[model samples]
Target: MGEVTEYVAGLHEPARSSIEGVFFIAREVVPDAEEGRSYGMPALRYAGKPLLAVMEAKAHIGLYPFSPAVIDAAADLLEGFDRTKGTVRFTPEHPLPEEAVRRLVSLRRDEIDAAIGRRRA
Candidate 1:
């Protein structure tokens, strides 16, 4: 199995399901994103840069968008969700909504695109 698949498979119920749901949203948002391990957790990359990562924590699942700006821009969508500078925390009982995941990925995609544009310019 691929690293992401293996990582997801290794997780127990609820966490496994939660991570899978995030993975599905990532695929939907960035069809070309490649899956692998980053920072010891399953992550997705686009255009050779980190897009998102998900890991099962002791009491919550963490979603990493790899950009504090993305988290800041998504404040509205993240209401009621516990978050740090770049990670959003949620419990299996209160997993992130698909729409919120979509917005987070979408914002991150835009950020990456902008960075690529800046580098090219």
Candidate 2:
């Protein structure tokens, strides 16, 4: 099995399903995103950068986009969700919506693309 699959499989119950759900949405948003580990967490890389990362914490599942600005921009959709500067925390009982996941991934992707463009300019 791949690293992501192995990581998700190692988790128990709701956590596994919750992580998988987020991964599913990310894949839908960026079909060509490459899967691997980032900072030891399962992540999807797009445009040669980490697009999203998923991890299970003691109480919630954490979604990391590695972009505080993207999280800030999605404040409306994150109303009822627990969030930190670079991570969004949601419980298995209250998983993040697919639409929210899609928006987060897309926004991060755009941000990365913009940064790449700036570097090349």
Candidate 3:
């Protein structure tokens, strides 16, 4: 299994499913995203850049897209979630909406593409 899958599998319930859900939505958004690590967290990398990372923290599940700008752009969709400049903290009881997750991955993927001088035709 991929490292991300392994990491997810090793977690307990709720967190396991919650984190897995974000990764699932992310994979659909960026089908070419590869399993990798970015800044010590297992992440989905697109165009060789950190696309997204979801981890279980003591208080919440944290989603890191590696871009403060992307988080800012999606602020409307992220209402009610605890957010930092670069991290969105959520819980399984109030899991991230699928739409929000999709937007996050898409925006991050676009950012990566732009930075790497690659355009999707």
Candidate 4:
């Protein structure tokens, strides 16, 4: 429990909650995942690399993944706001779709596995 995690966990509104909610969903999806603050933000990791990271932005909360392809795969749901290398902009006050988050997480893992296969190939 860090300052960032404490701050992020409180953003349970429509426009901002989704960012934290997605973080919640990701934490659950990863087996034996743990919570901590990294790089001045809330981070959830699996194995080693960060799986999900949440931070507050000027306009909205940023839900960032270690992999950018996951965000690309769920572009339909993302609907584009202020995005960066691996960050997706979302507000707690906006309606966050759970299914979309789930799909994105699941697909991201699949893509990761596929990428690993290519490397081994």
Best by lDDT: 3
Q: For candidate 4, which ten residues in a row score worst on lDDT?
A: 112-121
Candidate 2 lDDT, 6-57, residue by residue in tens: 8888989978888998998898888888888787777899877889999998
64, model 4: CA deviation in Å?
0.2
Winning model by TM-score: 3
Ranking according to TM-score, highest score first = 3, 1, 2, 4
Q: Which residues of candidate 3, in runs, are more than 4 Å off?
A: none
Stronger candidate by TM-score (2 vs 3):
3
What Cα-based lDDT does every candidate model obtain?
0.88, 0.88, 0.94, 0.64
Q: How accurate is candidate 1 locally (lDDT)?
A: 0.88
Question: Per-residue lDDT of 1-121 in model 3, one digit per residue for the tens?
Answer: 7779989999999899999999999999999999999999999998889999999999999999999999999999999999999999999999999999999999999998889899998
Q: What lDDT score goes with residue 102 in model 4?
A: 77
TM-score-superior candidate, 1 or 4? 1
Worst 10 residues of 1 by lDDT: 112-121
Question: How do the residues 16-87 of candidate 1 rate in per-residue lDDT, one tens digit apiece?
Answer: 988998999899989999987677767898887889999888988999999999999888989999999989
The positional error of residue 53 in candidate 3, measured at the CA in angstroms, is: 0.4
Query: TM-score for all predictions?
Result: 0.92, 0.92, 0.98, 0.69
lDDT of 3 at 50: 91
